[model samples]
Target: MKQSLILTILVTLTSFQRASAIPFQVRADLDSCLNSAGLTSIYPSSSGYASAAQAYNLRFQYSPAALVYPTSENAVAAAVKCAGSLNVPVSARSGGHSYAAYGLGGQDGALVVDLSKLKAITINSDQTATIQTGNRLGDVALTLYNNGGRAMPHGTSPEVGVGGHLGCGGFGLDSRMWGLFLDQALSARVVLSNGTIVAASPSENSDLFWAIRGAAPSFGIVTEYKFKTYPAPSSNIIFSYSYWSTPQATASSIFSAFQTFAQTSAPPTLGIQAILASAGAPGQLYVSLTGVFYGTKSDFNNAINPLLTKIPKPQGTSVVTYGWLDSLVQLGGQSLNTSTTPDGTDTFFAKSLMVPQEAPMTSAAIQSFFNYLGNQGTSSDTVSLTTLYSMHCEP
Candidate 1:
């Protein structure tokens, strides 16, 4: 089960928000409504509004009409009912880390429903876990591991909210074996535009069940999710390889070699991605291949050694084993605890896509792409890491 977007009937209102600023009176009216409903809220005039309205990416910042914290499902319904009546747009804020900032309504003056207080993880008698949308990936990881040695497939970012990550396509290093994080969902509780509480699953509201999993932003607000959990693997292999100060030709060959190996021989337990980054100066290419292999150290070596023979020796490389949770902490470069959520922000542009395996790029095409990448003079400020989803063969 997954609770997702609070985007619903008022979605149309978000488009008009940009045409002009919301009336000051409307803000006051919303402030009054929240007060009357007894919901914990912050208004623009409130000192906490600035922090409450903060989005994860510094590239985008939207002024929400009002930020409300609903502690229970009934309270979530009341908040929606209030917004639907006042014609105010609504956006649910879980981790507040949408790449496009859609979590800020993709516009201005929408009512931001902050779900931070709803972080709860319940291990059920069945082989499943019920998680509130407010819990971040790190929170979810630590809670499940500490309680029941349970695990689920999810992205590497710890601050990303479960609502947004799983609502979208939740992919992780282990996705090749377990599929997406969303695939673990059995059902979810949602608050509809009518302010009605409903359960969406395969057998109930089947249409909505499908819609929310892939595109929950336009559907309704999900409060909690019940997911099938897997026993945490005992052994995990985390690996990294970096090529620095490399020429375009070498970078292209490195990426090409990785693609060939990924498509032909990578195991499902092996999840890897190649990163192409712009170094300090123009014509400088920095490439890295990093991911996790969920198996014994000997087995990982047997699988990765063959791929190593195909490419030039990397300037830096690492192949170490760690416990399941430790592997996540190392790969994420942060603590996986909910005690204190991170508040880091960056301004950059990044996009992701998958290249078809049937029509792999010719060596000429690969060279051409790298040629342009090496010539780009953009600095770290404007351009950040660009990752290629090269693990397509790990079906």
Candidate 2:
């Protein structure tokens, strides 16, 4: 990979020397808007870019015609209008957590509306929470826990923006019982491409409401989201089980059994995740089955006990029950303070594949894929894989 990258760079330097077109009058217009809107600076070249992470890649950078921070929706509207008038590409960036660069991918000479200044969270008497575009996941969770344990199922990390999470169908441990984050969405205030501001809800702007629920980036800039909150459950029981197996086939059988058990009798309160990894054993797989049970210990035990025969093992298992909020802090990795980096953020790049069904060929295919991954030059410790059965809207 290193050699390939070096060769590509050498070829690029030798072959490419084209300059971009710039309109002097458009630059003057943009400068006028920036001055009036109190923007810090506008960078038209690579020097003005900074490294930022979406949920995935660590080294992603966005080169914007102007990285303008607006203090108000009106100011944002003004900037958007200016960009539209000048035929400039515009991308809205809240917390910069879009893994595929959906929020920061500039075509050329694009205007980036950075909404980090819009952070705000307010809880209403009806147990509904209003979150701004810039608010992060953990921030909202902590605030909700403090305000009386009124909480909603949110993404695992705290640095992810509320806008992106809800926009992309966010889910967490409690999702097996509740639903995706968009399921709780009540309303949103959006700034359209044409600079028209509108409020969307179940009753008003219903088409836009449906679109923004799951396909937000294709729509417009969502300034704020109102979500219906549930009374935070009192206690949560987390069960961890790790298995030691000899060969890939044995581990794969366990996974297949898990799929069967999860399908027939898994309770709504039980959410399970299996991590197939090679922590200590080379070419061997360790199956870590973790569960978040949203019920009393007795009820949880009763619900999961019937399926233990499917996972016959001499491996290790641990269970802990705590207040829901405290369990969240622990399970979501906030207790280690490793949830974010030194600058309060980390990058995660992940891809997902949906398996419609499993056959002999499918199992063999997966085994080959894992074998290839084990051969990669990078340390195996740096890579992780998790699979789960998502309970969508059934409960």
Candidate 3:
């Protein structure tokens, strides 16, 4: 074990809502449609509506017209049909973890198709998994580990729904080795806007398959996803190096070093990111370089040494290794193993940028970024910058 990060920042909770509410008659009509189709519907006047309509970000909280909990594909299709008939817009909520709360329609008065009740995973003999998209990354990880020594590239956040995560190009520690979660998707069962369920694959509904893999919510709702799986790695390790109260110059150097080393020297087995966070003192920020290596502890130090040699010495460091299930838990938290609750809510404002391997950040731009942060980065407490390269290496 080694030293870890030191700078700490506390967040203040804030709630935001528009002056919008659904009409009683419309909510009642949507509920009636869902109830007639054997689905559970919660209206604004109904109990548990507030909790059911809550967004993970808490900032984009909006009152939906109706919440539909569909237990089957037919129920999901029925809800779609009912929405079409009533001339209502519909949004599907998988984990309700959208930063912009698009799952809640990104606005009010949309019929929300809640899919928490539809999580079911099937591991086939050919190392393929047919899982309901309603399952979160945590649910998928635990099930794959328990049923078979299997794994797939997914998000580090366990609370993110597979439906939304994969669609938005899911990234994880396994991503460096296995590509994205969408890359493993073999097929999907999608309910179209007109209430028809169809199978999307390369050989069938080829256009629909392509659209669903990336921009799924734009087209329709996916009920289940058939994914290609891999044998879980026997040796999984996580490492982190923290620098406390780093000056803007050193922070800029570290960023430049990481970008250069990762594009050239970092192997596919390593997935890494950096964070420049508030240190509470003026002109002070802490930076941490952390990620998971899909190889053994014996080779981890060697793989990381080049990057460390390029950057300033870290004040604290830590390295740990675990098995398949434990590694997932370590990457996230205990929620990766047994997460039933909604986890935690936050009021956040975040922006992300992906730097491709073809074009690394220029030295001048890197310095400018740090300079701006030191001078005027107080709007947010922490800024996590993740740079992913497509090494295209085999596992």
Candidate whose lDDT is highest? 3
Tens digit per residue, CA lDDT, model 3, 202-232: 9999999998877888889999999999889
Count of backbone clashes for each model? 8, 2, 0
Q: TM-scores, in order shown?
A: 0.90, 0.82, 0.92
lDDT of each: 0.77, 0.65, 0.79
Question: Could you tell which candidate, 1 or 2, scores higher by lDDT?
Answer: 1
The whole-model C-alpha lDDT of candidate 1 against the native structure comes to 0.77
The sequence of per-residue lDDT tens digits that candidate 2 reaches over residues 1-395 is 00000000000011112233447777778877667767655456435455332213343444456667776777677777777777777777775666545566433456777777787789998889888887777778878878978888866766667777787677677776787788899999998888788999999999999998887877888889999888888878988878754455666666666666555677767877766655455556666777788989899988778667776673889999988667877776664232344334334444454443232224565566545433441244433344343321100
Candidate 2 accuracy as lDDT: 0.65
Point out the worst 10-residue segment of candidate 1 by lDDT: 4-13
Candidate 1 wrongly placed segments (more than 4 Å): 1-20, 377-395
For candidate 1, what is the TM-score?
Answer: 0.90
Which regions of candidate 2 fall more than 4 Å away from where they truly are?
1-28, 38-56, 106-108, 244-246, 279-282, 335-349, 356-384, 389-395
Give the per-residue lDDT digits (tens) of candidate 1, residues 89-136: 988888877866788787888998888889888999996999999989
The residue pairs found clashing in candidate 3 are none
> Alpha carbon lDDT of residue 198, candidate 3?
98
